[model samples]
Every structure is written in C-alpha cells, then in structure tokens.
Target: MMFNIELKDVGKSYGDNEVLRDIDFSVDKGSFTAIVGKSGCGKSTLLRVIAKLEETSKGTLTFSGEGSKDPKIRIMFQDDRLIPWKNILSNISIGAVNKAAAKESLQEVGLIDKEKDWPDQLSGGQKQRIALARALASNPDILLFDEPLGALDALTRMEMQNLIEELWQQQQFTSLLVTHDVTEAVTLANRVIVIDKGTIQLDEKIDLPRPRERDEKFTYYEKKILNQILGG
Candidate 1:
C-alpha cells in the first residue's frame, strides 16, 4: 500500500546553521504519528517543513492518494493563535464562515455555546478548544499539531488529550504531532519518532491499543522512549 506522506532524505539549514540532517520517514493513511525531542532538536521545524510552512533545504516530500491536490492540511500550535478581536465563532471560522460547519466544529470541541464570546474571555482550555475547532473546521486531510497542549494545566491537558484522541478516531484523519511530552505521545500516537541533534534517532511502533491508560505498561513505554531520546 502507498503511504500518505513520504519524506526522503530531507534536511534543512539556516545559512551555516544546520537544523535537520538527512531525515527520512513515512506515514500510512489514517495513522497518528508523534515526533518528540528536546528543545531545538528540530521537531517543530520538521512539522513546519512537512506542512510547507518552511521549505526544506534538501530532499523531497510527497503526499499521495486522494486529496493530494489541496491536501486540506491544518495546523494547531502551542499558543491558541486566535484573534482577540474575533468572537469564538468568527475565530473558529477564520473567514470561511460556513455557519453550519462552524457550529459543528465548535460543538465537537464543546464550545458551541461560546460562539458570541471574545477569545480573551475564554479560559486557557477553551482557547485551545477554539484552536482545535478551527483546525477541524477546515476538514483537513492531515492535522499538524505543534505542542498544541503545551500551555494547558495538567487537568486541561489531560482533557485535551482525550479530546484529540476522540476526534482522531471520529475523523480518521492522518495526524503528526510534535510534542516534548513522552506520555502524551505514547497516549495519542500509533508510532513515535524520536529526533535528536537534527537527526532521527528512533522510529518505533507504539503497539499499544487505543484509549491507552497511564498505567505501568504505559509508564514503561514512556521510560523507553525517554531513554531512546536521551541516548540512555
């Protein structure tokens, strides 16, 4: 079967500063993949490169199968990135303004009632929910999440994690998440890619079932991933 995303010997640099080197990977259709690494390891940079927000210094990226023309890609970031001037509905719509689609996306994130409220008036969790709704409203073929829950508190982070998992299952969209949280990656991803010093150190299958609990088994896998990332 053909893969949905393919990156062959990809690399990137800023003048003399090389940020990524000879990276390679592929993602199957409907798969959820996570990239984790320490700060400045080029995890987010890889996501940006894949999303075409940043051009690669070398190599090729290929998107296959249906929806390849436009790809309907969406990105959610660490910050909510919502406009303070826009209300929740407008923020979610982002000028698409399909009332039915906006309503459905907001309801999916449990923010349907806050449509009239300004972004500044929502809680951190709600702001993130709006971000999620915005991403979903686009009906993306692939969702690129760059530390989307990094700013939330523990409880909110857990909630958002569950929400993302649920949404992924419901939407069946291919996803690539760039996160520093090992447990979060384990919980949400079917495969985890570990990058270090501008290189991919490990690309391992999670093999864990969906709705994974943070029990001993999950903890073990988390430790193993941490060790791989840290070169332990």
Candidate 2:
C-alpha cells in the first residue's frame, strides 16, 4: 500500500485508434516523474488516463496507500484555465474549503498581492502561478501537469520551473508531468519516462542531485531520451 498510484496493462482507445497500450508503472508516494514523447505519441493520453480524465479501455488502475482509497488528485494544464470574470483569490478558492487555505496557496505561489486582481490584469506566467495555486489549494496527494509551462517565455518558464521544484521539495506531493521539453523533464523529474507509439520506450532514473544543472550527465540523459524519441 505504499504506492500512491499503479497501472497494470493499462490501455486506452477511441474506437480504432489505440492511444496507450500495455502501460504498466507504479508511482511511489511523494515522487516526481515526467513523461515525454513526440507529439501524438500518447504521453498526454497516458496522463489523462491516470488522472481519470479519460477512462481506460483495458486493465486496472489502482490507488493505494495509507488512507488513500479516495485520495485527493489535482491536475494543472498549459492553458492556465483561469476564469476571466473572477479575481485571483476567488479563482484559486474554487474548490478550497476556506479563503484562508486559498490565500495560503496563493502565498505559496508568491501572488498574495494579486488577490483582488482580475485574471486579465495578470501576465501569462502569473496566471499559471494562480493555476498552480488553485491545484495546490486542495492539498492533492498526486499532482499531474500537462505541459503547464509550455506557454511561458523562456525566462519565465525557467522561473516557474524553479518555483515548482521548490514547492515540490517542500510539499513532497506525488507529481507526474507530461512535457515535450526533455530538458524540462530532466530538470524536474526524479525519473523520466519516454513514450513512443503509445508505449513506454525508455524509463530512465535521474540520479543527478537536485537543483540539477545542465551538466554533462544531465546532457547525456537528455540526449539519450531525445534519441529514443527521435529514433536516433
């Protein structure tokens, strides 16, 4: 019962289109994992299936842990998905039990000052922070990210990455990120999974120390994953 999530022979399909097949993995509690692959390679589909946003067509998806029969799971996306009409505070408070919890989450993202500001007034990166705050407000046991930083400019993206890593280190929530950027995957995840043609091609453990650099070892793993994805 130590694992937070497990998939056994999982499969997903839309009629004749098979998006994921024979997927098998177990996510350790409080671990960070990244899934990467080319466009249309079903990486996102795997996350969706695990998140129950899309039901699997075959096999079992199990949730187990101490008091995890009905675990709290949250997902963040690249779109930021904020409600334009609501102010920053209210947006993150959507599922929160109280304004205090929402405020704490907002503060965690370093956006407490923007509480009363509308979503339109905030920049793209700020909006995404609010999105992350909203996801964190629920105190999720598992957090899934579907390319949440894809829309940001380079510097902002790196900033968000740092913020995310800091928060993850502090909170120790189980995380799964689906990203097209191998560097992003290598930088954040303790383990990186490469998917091709709807199945996992390489599952590499990133033994590099945290606050990881794009050092030689980092580049080696990055190139290995890239080669796997590109069929090099």
Candidate 3:
C-alpha cells in the first residue's frame, strides 16, 4: 500500500499575507524528505498543508496509490505531546492497536523499559522517544516529523537521529521531515527542499550513501543548503 504525495502549483495565504506561493512539490513513496528554511519562510506551512491540518488557499494536493481512500499519515512534533497522567505504555497505546503493539513501538525506540514511567518522570529525550513510539504505534504509511529532535542535546540528538533512521529503514514508510538543521537534513533525507520567502528556493537530491558521515561531500550539501537559506 505505497502512496505518493503531490502538490501542484500550491499557494497558501492568510488574509493578505501569502505564506506559500506557486509551490510545486511532490514526495515519492517510501523516501525520506527534509524541508529546510529560515524561520517564517513557510516551510512548516507547506508541511501543514500536506498533512491537511490547514487548507491551501489555491492549487491541488493529492495522494495516489493502491486504494481510493487517503493514505494513513502520522506526525511527530518538536514537543513530545505526551499525557502527563498516562504512563509511557498507556500513552503509546492510547489510539494504537493494543498494548502489545504499543510495547513493540516502545521497544523500537529503545524505551520498552521505561513503559512504567510517567512522562514527567522521564527526561526530555526520553519523552520525545515516547512521542516517536506513539506515532509509530499507529503503523502510519507516511510519517511526518516537525523538528522532533530540535530540543535534545547534541549527543542525544545524534542518537535519536540514528534511531529514526534505523526505524525508517526497517519500516520503509514515506517520511517528510521539517528541520532547521542542515547537517541533520543531509544525514537523514534522500532529498532536501529549501523554502525561502514563501516559495521553493531549491530542491537538492542527497546522493550520498547511508550511515552518512560528516565528510567532505556531506559538508558540501550542508554548506550549499545553509548558503541558500542565508541568501548566499
């Protein structure tokens, strides 16, 4: 049940202020794409439109694939968004298949042992892992990440990145990630799209091999994206 996403000539606005203009973007099924841009550049808006959280002011957004129904989509945000009252297992199992399925999702994020802990009992990174598990428990066909690692410290962020990549490779779900981190984008995404000033500025393919290192080629893509975002 693979699904591909398409957005043709999409434009979004609020009143007189345009957030996205004449955007033409498409995401291939089972590929990881990262959207990068400076703050207020409408990168998140583009994702929201795809997620159908907000409607486009103009243009078409559609999904095409095996069935007539829409694809199953899930989003993981920067905030963990966990229930303080619910234990970790209950949190992931809230809308999940069952407790066993929720436990599997927790295990995938390396937090099965924390299933008994409260959200407040865990650290920031642990909370985010629970959030990821919750999103995964749904068995989404498309997983959207909105800077989920933004709040973690450097080492924990790297670990989370590795976990995400591992799970993504294993699950093979289509992923769209919105991040301000160029290095992270290069590390995780098959393609990187740069949104600038309410429009698509650059769409660059990351041709490097996986388990990516911050080597010369990696930095090259990073610098290129950073420059584009910085208006270089």
Residue 195 CA error for candidate 2 (Å)? 0.6
lDDT of 2 by residue, 1-232 (tens): 2337899999999999999999999889889999999999999989988888889999999888796587778899999999999989999999986889999999999999999999999999999999999999988888999999998999999999999999999998889999999999999999999999889899999999989998999999999999999992
Which parts of model 3 have CA positions greater than 4 angstroms off?
Answer: none
Model 1: ten consecutive residues of lowest lDDT: 65-74
TM-score for each candidate, following the candidate numbering: 0.96, 0.97, 0.98
Candidate 1 error regions (>4 Å)? 1-3, 95-97
The CA lDDT of each predicted structure is 0.89, 0.92, 0.92
Pairs in steric clash, model 1: none
Across 53-109, the per-residue lDDT of candidate 1 in tens digits comes to 999999998888753445767899999999998788988888343878888999999
- Report the CA-based lDDT of candidate 1 relative to the real structure: 0.89
Cα error, candidate 2, residue 164 (Å)? 0.6
The better-scoring model by TM-score among 1 and 3 is 3
Local error of candidate 2 at residue 68 (angstroms) = 3.0
lDDT of 3 by residue, 1-232 (tens): 5579999999999999999999998899889999999999998998899889999999999998786568888899999999899899999998787888999999999998999989999999999999999998988888999999999999999999999999999998899999999999999999999999888889999999989988999989999999999992
The window of 10 residues in a row where model 3 has the poorest summed lDDT is 64-73
